[model samples]
Target: MNALLVITALLAATPITLEETRTQGRKNTQALQAELDVTVAREDQRSARSNLLPQVQLSAGPNLSYQGRRRQVVTIPVTETEVLTREVVSSANTSDSYGASLGLSQVIYNRGLWKQLEQAGVNVDAVRNQSIEEADTSELEAIRRFFTLFLSQATLDVLQATAKRSEEQLERARALFHAGRVGKTEEISAEVNLGNDRINVVQRQSQLVADQVQLAVWLARPGTEALQAVDPGILQQEPAPAPALDDALKQAREHRALLRALQQRVRVAELQRAIVRGDYLPRVGLQAQYAHGNQDLGPFFSEPGFGNTFNGGVTLTWDLFNGFNTDAQSARAQANIRRAELTFAQTARELEAEVRRAHQALDGQIASAKLATTNRAAATQGLMLAEERFRAGAGSTLEVRDAQLKLTQAELVLLQSRIDVEIARYALYRATGTLNPGDSQ
Candidate 1:
């Protein structure tokens, strides 16, 4: 009993709503990788920005030396008038020394470096936009899976209900045949219908299981079986009006992440051109250094050894020329900028067409849903009338069977139409770059 209860609880914990599905789907590998890319880009931007600040360095080390024994000559005064020469011997000795230096450098002017820093910032924005696009894609996929699972469940429910009705019809036909009110053919026909419905039910159940496994994989669930999709009753609601084409296009222009990323790339390329051109100008900086050390004037430390030095200066560097390398790079940067601009233009056109296509599709599906609703209502009434006539012995078994089949067809069509309408609406939203998990209803 406890084990069964635990299983039931786990089953209930499975996500069924669109929001929950989106929450799970956001952990998809592609989306996470995009986020990681954005983080890396941000780090690069920081590194580039840090180059504008002063750089400081410190160094310290010890030095060692040795001297070999050698002979030296000395002159001495004698009787204040004559000088005497003598030979002197110097002993071998060793000395140890240590020094430390601290230096600071700050760039006063480096146009190329500043331009490169700007490019880094733009690259970060591009990566961030890509991450948003990836997240939206994953969320849209989750929405698709949610609806697929819902449709499968709805289809199976319909099959099961039809199968139950076929069973009753079969039983009734057999009773009438035994009473001589109907023939064996009628009984056989009813049995055949029941068998077909059962087969359909089995097939639909298999499909439902497959869809469940698919959704489970997205959710990272270990078990694929025993999942259930509860209907959110979206089908019963009235269809919403289609969005205006002008509005959709405007939204696509304003909100599309991929387009924005492309625009950022164009800016990046323009910055790259400026950076390359900046190489033609001189770079200026200010630098300062302080050093302190102790060393023996003689190998035996015979003299004062402590000393310190401080220095400060301005520096300038000019490339002048480097085998036309800067010119070639500048040309390449310009070409890349052109390429980026063209890509953005092409994508903008494609996006507008996509929105228009989606708008038309949504409108069509809404019309289909409205038609299906009317057909289903008529089918329901026809089935009731056929059943009444058959119970009164004024109609044949075939008429009742036909009515039931028509009603089943109508119901299936209605279900499909409703699903299509919702899918179309979301497809439009995706095309306009407005799709999100919250819109899944």
Candidate 2:
């Protein structure tokens, strides 16, 4: 067990990838809450369905009673020729009784009840779709957090490299000054550059720590520990082509879980209106019951003669007038239906806009990544030439520093542009509602 615990801890400390982040996110609190909502909706549907089925009930109890007689009427024949009557007090006694009853009831026809069942079924569908939407959203958010942490790490890496290079330049300048070959100005310039570079590195490190905490929170892990992301290495490859705007919009309409859930809601609202209308109609049902009981004048639980009863009947009920309650309910249901329809329409428009925006962003990022790639190449060449010239005594300290700074900026830009391309692609996938976290596409 101790060895197992060590291994688990080691695994937990390992850097996480995009796929792992999304997998853990599926078990996050929001996703779990959405799943519970679906369970509750399913149970509601079952309850509604039960209204149409037969219901059986059984009841049993022991009954105890005591009565004191106040008065009684007695009649007797007196001497075979006359009759006498008198009023007199009676005795008190206790009686014990046991009784049991079984009953069954079934709805023959209740339009409103049937409509409610249908509405409940639609509600289940809506809740299920909403759960899917929530899960998808969680996965997308995980992807975002993963990329943000990766960007922070990449930026820090670039800054540290620049700082290291600046330190070397400073050492070179100090050596020249000690040998009386370069003036104090050159040494001072190099010192100031290194100091600034070190400061930037410190700032980047602080940002990195904050990014780690954010990623850990999204993963539902302890924020006290730091988190790292494994590079997806998308930077090594050429940017993939972005899809056409119209195609993305089409996919969004077809596959978005939110849209499907809203459509289900509209159906539910319509069914609710139907149920309200059904309240105006009469209802029919069937009922049956059987009872058995025994009473004794002696002690409790004593044997006594028993009696049985059975009853069965068909029942019909109609509301001649209800204080406009049904009318009010009908109006509310109609309003709900209209609201559902309008919400769906509004969402559709917003979704289209989202898809278009994501597509445009992907296109722009791809172009920027390509341009940054070229610029980085140029900066590298410029840095090499400047170092060669400085060693050959043909370049000033300021020129070398300028080249170094440009190269550093170029590298950072390229890194950011590449990462942005990936982020933009992910946004497009999310907008199209087709982003499966671990999928290669």
Candidate 2's residue-wise lDDT over 287-388, tens digit each?
999987777434223543347789999999998789999999999999999999999999999999999999999999999999999999999899889877
Best by TM-score: 2
TM-score of 2: 0.90
Instruction: Indicate the residue-level lDDT of 432 in model 2.
Output: 86
Q: Model 1, 139-218: lDDT tens per residue?
A: 77777777888887787668777877888888888888888887899899999998888788768766866787887776
Clashing pairs in 2: none
Model 1: ten consecutive residues of lowest lDDT: 296-305
TM-score of each model, in listed order: 0.85, 0.90
| lDDT of model number 2 | 0.84
Steric overlap count per candidate: 0, 0
